[model samples]
Target chain A: MSITPFNIPIVPKLKKETIYSLARKGSRIDKRKLDQFREIKITLGAAGKAHGSALVELGHTKVLAGVKIEPGRPFSDMPDQGVLNVSAEFLPIASSEFEPGPPDENAIEVARVVDRALRESQAIDLGKLAIIPGEKVWVVWVDINVLDHDGNLFDASMLAAMAALLDAKIPQHEILEDGSVRIIGPPIEPLPVKKRVVSVTIGALGNVFLVDPSLEEEAVLDTRIMFSFDEEGNLVGMQKTGAGWLDWDKVAIAFNIARNKYTVPLRALQGAFKS
Target chain B: MSGKKPPFPLLKDGKRHDGRGPMDLRPIQMKVGILHNADGSAWVKMGRTEVIAAAYGPREPPMKAMILPDRAVIRFRYHMAPFSTDERKSPAPSRREIELSKVIREALEATILTHLFPRTVIDVFAEVIQADGGTRTAAITAASLALADAGIPMKGLIAGVAVGKVEGQLVLDIDQVEDEYGEADMPVAAIVGLRKIVLLQLNGVLKPDEFLKALSMAWEGLKRIYELERSVLGSKYKGV
Candidate 1:
């Protein structure tokens, strides 16, 4: 048995009304189009000791992702392949509504959503990471820490994680005479990343869809849907959260918007990695 | 996406491993009011998967903070018994259970009339005694019955189902083997009369068009299951 996380972000009635009415007119409080996104800024190799790290800012929301790879036992189900574990923690400093505690449903949901996208897309060549068939393998961990809370944590956190993984350097290892593997060199080889997966999150203000919503807009959303796509526009993962419902028409429109609009952020991420 | 084939064939000529067609569901059997002491109870068996669900409360909430001012807090938990599967899962809650519990709660909450019982708590528990596949959706279907049997006023009933791709052919109500070996699996729940999807989740890869087609297929399955729920509850409450 577990307790539910408290309802978040007590929003003002006037703010909700203002956001909703403007949305119905195909406008946003931030003066962006229904499908337009805010500017994204990324910084990599910032964490001192982590194998890899990246900090991404989507508008005012800030998330930092750090990658750590270690030797660990393989899961029984996939003994021949390595494991990818993703975890997200919302620091109390990130928002007044957040507190110091174990991850609640919000944290768990976002983490799982990101994990599914990466694993399902086979973004990394996990099968090549096994050191021993059933006993040991390289475990890649992507830990996303929200440093600031604005809105659309899913998109920002995902970008930070993607950048971090691309920047990661796998630790060099050697097999000893007794059959034990040892990390004998500094992290050098680039992680075996194969694909670039981007995610889009659309928030509904009634029937209107707003992409990459700000914090104020999130407080007023009836519900939000998140979708992940690979470079080729293949759908890899999807999750619809919030206690509200989406009609089939709204979903179709959102899907169309997601399929076309993912490249905006995908280009942003790719450009950041290049620079 | 169709390059690697499954070790064992999951489909042959549009027929599944168990002889179900592309759009056919597994044989479903259900019973309500099985637990006399519970305010509401139900047992559901769809193929090899079995589940029992119970609802209690609209009683005083445990903590003052949890009591809502404008709506009752509807709490739903989906748990699997230790013997539910072949591998004997531990009693402790796994990450999958924690996430599923929340997903199921949100799905069912869409239809419940929580405003009618403000400052109280309505609790529903769905325990999977046997699981092959599509446990969350089945749990939601059963829990909705339990809530209705408890006399909780809901706007509508929820019907849950899963659709998957086997051998590049779309199929309905996937079994455990197909779920494990299939290239794609998506679980969906919807309010049939309202024509609204309450819960939707997906894993594996699909083209956008394939995804859309799969959703439509899942909706059709939900409509059929929704009718079964209406008849069962009608028989219990209205003696129809």
Candidate 2:
């Protein structure tokens, strides 16, 4: 869980404040191209102690994701498959309304979006994580901490997680005599990573669609569509959140815009892993 | 700060298990004006624990709670994050948190000039993102800073410090491990005014002599923190 329910800074009613003038002028307050995203900045290995970590700033929205790998007994049901556990923490420093407690619906939805994108895309080669074929495997624990909440946290978290996972490396393990795993040494080889996944969030505002809504934009958005696009521009998963419905034509338009805008950041992720 | 007796008597080596000396305080980092929307806010980092406080409204008080004719109501809510520690915490505040809230409220009420705004409610919300040790103290300190930042009138800035006994020696600012495994943990909220003591809460065992000595240690460290708070506020409100 990331944020508390009582202090959720987002006020849906605040959206009403913008209806009159913006609709009259057919423009946004920030005056950005309708399809343009907020400014983005990504940094890798920010938490030096963690196995892998990255800090992502999508405009004013900031998220830090740290990946920790630990060797432990595999789940009895699926001993062979590795595990990926995602957790989120929404800090109050980001916004005044963030109360402290278990992750609220917003945080849960963010984690679920990132988790589903990772799983459905098969971004991690789980088969290579198996040590003894069916006994031991590497479990990747990704903790995403939301340091600031200016908006578009979902996209920022996904980017941070992906960047951190790419920066992570698992050590070689040997099955012990007591059916336990013994730490041998650093992995002589790197874990196999099949594909890279990233997500882009677009919001619909009064017949106009915008990408990566800012904190102010997020308050007024009626519908938000998060598109998970791979490096090849293939859509892996698309989730429509909130109450508003999107016409089929608008959905198609948003997909194309996401695919096009995604490559710019996707290339940045590749370069981040390279360095 | 290190190089003293151990903080926990039950633990071995006269060494606090968390690797701090008896008189040592945890690493603390504080930043003011973190929240854009709040009138004033602060982020306090005590060891690995992160606590944020925001002050909102001297707005019209909630009608039901406005029975008081002279003084404004100070409403406070203290909450810990679910993933702040190893164990998962429930969403709602527990008995301990509720009690801590009362202690904190009492402490702040004494220092803040609530009578200045009779018909308003000042909201002080403290959210603990991470809980290592001495969270209540940190929250108190942060809340005072937030209130000051919000430009609310007050007698003086209040700073909270804790002094606990370990291995029969007094330690300042107990960490999570020491607080959990030590002999006694005492947390105090001190004001810069002539009345130094505003709130004090102690748990576990301690002799009267030990209690007095621990109280003195807390006051000494608290004086230093109060100066820090003043300097920070001065710099923030310079020329204004």
Per-prediction CA RMSD (Å):
1.9, 20.6
User: Model 1's lDDT to the true fold?
Assistant: 0.86
Query: Which CAPRI category fits model 2?
Result: incorrect
- Measured with C-alpha atoms, the lDDT of residue A44 in candidate 1 is 90
Worst lDDT run of 10 residues, candidate 2 chain A, spans A1-10
B70-183, model 1: which lDDT tens digit per residue?
778878888999999989999888778888888888777788898898888889999999999989888989998898888898888888999888777788888788888887
**Stretches of candidate 1 above 4 Å error?**
A1-9, B1-7
| lDDT by residue for model 2 (A148-177), tens | 988888789889989888878776667778
lDDT of 1 by residue, A97-171 (tens): 888998877788888889988988999889888888888888999999999999999999888988899989889
Residue pairs that clash (backbone atoms under 3 angstroms), model 2: A1-A103, A2-A90, A2-A103, A7-A97, B6-B14, B7-B166, B9-B167, B22-B171
* TM-score for chain B of each model, two decimals: 0.95, 0.90
